[model samples]
Target: MTQSASPPNRALLELPQVQRERLSHIDFKLYFLGELRRTDVADRFGTGPAAATRDIAQYKELAPENLVLDNTDKIYRPTANFVPLFDHAPQRVLTALSRGFGEGIGEELKPMVRCEFPMALSEPKMSILAPITRAIHRNKAVRVSYTSIESGRSEREIVPIALVNNGIRWHVRAYDRRRKGFRDFVFTRMENPVLLEDSPITDEEKVDQDVQWNRIIELELVPHPAHPRPEVVMMDYGMPDGVLSVKVRAANAGYMLRRSAIDCSPDHSLSGPEYALWLKDPLALYGANNAQLAPGYRNPRDDSENKPIKAL
Candidate 1:
């Protein structure tokens, strides 16, 4: 979260308060210049139009020679003489320089990890974004050519209604005209997209408001004393000692399990005879691993033929 410095309440904190007030005034002035109309300026500052008008007049009085009236729009604008006072290009340049230096250090420390995923910029891909944004804004239907992994062929005339990002990829949430229901289309798999002139689909059952399809997995791994701790993995929520556990929300449980294999070092031990894999919610699996088992505790997988009992 980004936060601005708070203003002080007493004389002892006068310096900081004055600095905050000055910064706030500069921000408001820039906003007024960019937005033009006094109504827009007043709306931004949460002040009445009369107060905004008075402030504009006072600003012009202080810098009489630095204000210019826009005849076309019947609005006042700041001249070149006043531009230097509000210009933020120097601050932006400093911010870019700082970010570049920090990214360089991060790249050196983690050579194998890429900061962001690569997205291919093809003409069809670029063209889809505009219509998708428009469809989202207008709440209309869009026709698109999409490829399906199961079908192994490109299908045309799919109606898309929403756009979604699943961290690693982008997808379009749409009502399939052929299937007569909602489906998700991967952006990379879309070949061609065209806006449809037909009326938007209005079936309530087909619209999905909650698009996130993720399940949380809590895994408890006991590391061996000999093996060093995993360095690259993020342990946002964990308990250290011999036991290490994490709550990972994932769209694909198998993919997450495969990725977590790297974090479980060779020296770690299992906690139970048949690792205690408990599914908190039947719809999703949530489980734990153990180094040793309690005597006479039956393996959870023994009764279920489909369940795979294996080491982390």
Candidate 2:
């Protein structure tokens, strides 16, 4: 539901695609960046002042409560009652925030803003990605030539339920027929993907069957016990109570922990410079198939009683 949502300004749907896209851009700038100038719209769309004014006027007509014009600053600031007229994906917004926009738009056009962060290390080929994504959208299976670290290259049919970005790379969370279970297939390693339109997914292959993906677990992270300045770590992570709690799917818990360099060891044994936080309850990761991916993670049951840990 978060991936896509109905636009509040249903009237905007009646407009042509080109105009609607421009209006959406305006709405994005206002909602995310707090202020948007008329020239910002003009520069992004390569339009003149007159055309930009007309677009703004149309947006004002559509959602008068959304923005307020500041004559002194010549910027449109978001009003308190502002509700997004367009649904913006979190991934797209984060990309724009971190890398700036102007993605394939043009070199002449300026980026949304200056941004600095680690860029994507890999991207999947569109030829293979398209059909796989189409399969997910259509609720069907896909035939793919996949290469895995453990098994090497193999041809397989998979029922893809969702696409996951584990921070560093992309994955298709699918039901692997050969394995008789759900697994995450790296996108870049998949080749020659073909959508099997005739293959109707059975109840067993649906997302409901994937316990790790459906189950949510809350992780409690605190400053590394050995850290010299625990207060600084708390401030940095906005942990007023010296604890940062996050709820994530069991399928993604390991990736989240690894991505943030949180020490997942029960004893807080990780001494690396990258580790700023430690998982307060290593037992919280019980039943998480991907927990092995977490740095220094050890199953608490490996040394003690193997009882089911209560879900948070």
Candidate 3:
């Protein structure tokens, strides 16, 4: 028989939620950024110097081997045997790094760093998103009223496997019961999402069964032939050999291509300043369903049939 895993530190779990959150913040910075200070904790949590000090001391007491104080810099750095107190997800960590941390604590807490980026025009409604996310977490299906431009409004059941943000918008990758296939449902278009806790999902509805999502496609991108100063393009992409190779899920290849403004025509036909990179071989995307989203791509079979007939 397989051995069961050990439980979390009982004393750590017994601390107040606020203190636990502060400890998690300390662990997050130490593990990722390699150092922490009392002021860092105070600024992030809006706590006094004494409270921050107490929290750090508390964390050290709970995990004695996790950190060591550098007397010269007065900073706490991770020790050789450092272990994280929290399970930080990669997506959450990346978002915090890009946008600044403590977003969920409250709107009053200012970002730790000065940063700016183009604002997303829209977001999914929490009312609809909450239950869908709950279903995803609990491994259950959800019934939803969804609308699509191509098919209009309809009622459907879906087993949500993952959520995807395709540069412009957020969508859920799920097994659509009505269509009997895996489909991307834009989160904003969903309404009245009700988790089907009693409805058991089958093997077919699981993420493993999604072929396009499981398959990986390699894309070889190079500077566009018509681009002025191709060397600058190469340098911008850090491609010393004049090629940037990207591996993406076949389901998301077209989105990645479109988001990067890559020219995907077989002849490098698209011309514009924005088209810095061109797909070295458009055939690499032949089997991708979303390949139509790529700029200037025409199926080879369609091109062959369009050729004008010549006299023998």
- Ordered list by TM-score, greatest first: 2, 3, 1
Residue 207, candidate 2: Cα error in Å is 1.0
Compare the candidates by lDDT and give the number of the best one: 2
- Residue 144 in model 3: lDDT: 94
Per-candidate TM-score against the hidden true structure: 0.39, 0.74, 0.72
Poorly placed runs, candidate 2 (over 4 Å): 1-39, 42-94, 98-110, 303-312
Measure candidate 1: CA RMSD: 14.6
**Candidate 2 local accuracy as lDDT?**
0.85
lDDT, ranked from best to worst: 2, 3, 1
In the range 145-249, model 2's lDDT, one tens digit per residue, is 998877789999999999998889888899999989999889889888988878878999999999999999999999999998999999999999999999999
lDDT of all predictions, in order shown? 0.46, 0.85, 0.84
> What's the number of clashes in each of the models?
6, 0, 0
Model 3 clash pairs? none
Give the lowest summed-lDDT range of ten residues in model 1: 288-297
The candidate that achieves the highest TM-score relative to the unseen native structure: 2
Q: What lDDT does candidate 2 reach at residue 272? A: 71
Q: Residue-wise lDDT of candidate 3 within 1-312, one digit each (tens)?
A: 111212488998898898888988998888877899999899888889999999999988887888999999999998877777777787887678766786444565454445566799979998988898898899899999998877789999999988888899888889999889988889989989999879999999999999989989999999999998999998999999999999999888878888889999899999989999999998998888788777777677684522321210
Clashing pairs in 2: none
